[model samples]
Target: MVERVDEQDRVLAVVGRDEAVRRGWLHRIAVTVCRDREGRILVQRRSEHLARFPGHYEVASGGAVAVGESYEEAASRELAEELGVQAPVRFVVKFLNRNGLSPHWLAVHEAVLPGDPNPDPDKMMWHGWLSESELLRSMEENLFTPDSRDTLSHYFAAAERPSGQP
Candidate 1:
């Protein structure tokens, strides 16, 4: 079962992923950004069989949270399921997705990959390690999913900000 969440991302109910999305419910999503030893980000090409944003590139590995699962729990599960690697996850931020296609709450997390990722064939077509500039170029060229595009921009912009500022 999937989690149906409130505006604050508090659990409101439980339902199937398809049904939750069909009803435009506010759900919790866990987005994980994995960096390589050289600090390049791992990006994935989504499989065509996926429900949303099929065949698009994603800079993060993630999915909706299940019922009774916390953001951290989902992040760990998704990281392993999609990339087959595990590392300590640092919580980043959360926001509401108001796009007509995916109305939900998104939680961002960061981790370091131990090595190259072994992507699930059913979840992704391939994976690549890209520098921040390359990732931004790809996004500007519209090669990434809407969610990934927004999340990457937000994450990178925040990472570049001065520490003392809010």
Candidate 2:
């Protein structure tokens, strides 16, 4: 078993070894899904040096929430660390893991920005605008993080519905 840690670095719960085998204890991660005025989502290519998910496209910016930090704080920190820009961010979704790949609760956010994105080469190597349709296709093709695909699907579905409708 593994102990899940909260934002304050406190142990929240003990999870089974099998559960940990897939994703381990639950952790919080911040994900930023920025959209341009054209309604295209920003995707990034992970650095080749990344230990995991190397050379794959992913959310605009993301990272694990630090101990003693809020989701917003983690989001902003990741953006600045990975994208080198500042913008307003709003909470859009919270994705809970059901597959046991990782005991992570994703805090997804949306950030609107002007002009093109300049990715930090240290963490990311490429950036591009992908429409929702294209993103779904990529997800089907296994081009993104497993957790990201789930969150994006939920976000896309919510966006397609009328306001205040679930």
Candidate 3:
């Protein structure tokens, strides 16, 4: 049984429909943050060995929020683990509904790195910087996770404006 915690971080007994569900504890949340330099946003190609979205492009960093960890903590950990770098993360948005998978609450963040993103081969196969136009075009031609597309759209909209606009 997975322990559920309240906003105050106190452990609470699982209850109601949440208790009846057989799926593993739904406590994990993942956040994906995409950042750009000079109109190009960093993107990572998931290793072909990935269980889902193999060989597909996705935001620079993302992973499961560990038990008792906050959304920002998970996002920062993922960024460091996947890219070997660290930067201040700014919350952009959150996505909570996905079908056919364990439910996850995602807190999207944005951050600008000092240089190119170097993907860790152990986690991702490749990385690159693509303009919003190019990313959107790719989405039109093939399949990406709905989460990716939604997050990309938000990033694109933000990038369209001048610095400090948001």
Candidate 4:
């Protein structure tokens, strides 16, 4: 079940994921921007079998926020599920993504994996770690997931902000 929400992200009710998709109901999603200790970002080609954004490259591992789950909890679960790693993640930003397949409030987080990720084949067909510059360059040549691209942009913007500013 997914928690349906209003434009302001206040939960309205719990509904089936499919129903939410069918009706274009707003919901919560948690995204994680993962990086290795060497500062290379992890990128993956999503499995072609997935219904949404199949075969697109993504810089993050994430999914819908399950009913009763916090954004941090969802982010942690998704990172482990898609990348096979358990690590602490920090909250980054939250914003409404109206341009995606469906509208949702996205909570973005950041994690530094302890070691190489063993990506699940069911989620991604290929995975690699790339420098920030390389990832930016590759984005121009790859069909990357739109939400991940937005997450990356917001993440970079947050990093560039002054510490005292929101």
Shift of residue 91 alpha carbon in model 1, Å: 0.5
lDDT of each: 0.83, 0.72, 0.64, 0.91
The lDDT of model 2 is: 0.72
Candidate 1: clashing pairs of residues: none
Indicate whether candidate 1 or candidate 2 has the larger TM-score: 1
Q: How well does model 1 score by local distance difference test? A: 0.83
For candidate 4, write residues 43-92 as lDDT tens digits: 99999999999999998889999999999999999998988999999998
Give the per-residue lDDT of model 2 (tens digit) for 50-131. 7667777775487777656678888888887788878888877666654325667777888887777667887787888889
Q: Please give each candidate's TM-score.
A: 0.90, 0.79, 0.74, 0.96
> Model 3, range 26-115, lDDT digits (tens) per residue?
444456565666857777778888776677777547766665667788888888888887877877755553432445455677878878
lDDT of 1 by residue, 122-158 (tens): 9899789999888878777756787886787667766
RMSD of each: 1.9, 4.6, 5.0, 1.0
Give the Å shift of residue 55 in candidate 2.
0.7
Worst 10 residues of 1 by lDDT: 93-102
Looking at model 2, residue 42 earns an lDDT score of 89
Candidate 3 has an lDDT of: 0.64
Model 3, residue 68: distance off in Å is: 1.8
Which residue ranges in model 3 land beyond 4 Å of their true spot? 1-25, 154-166
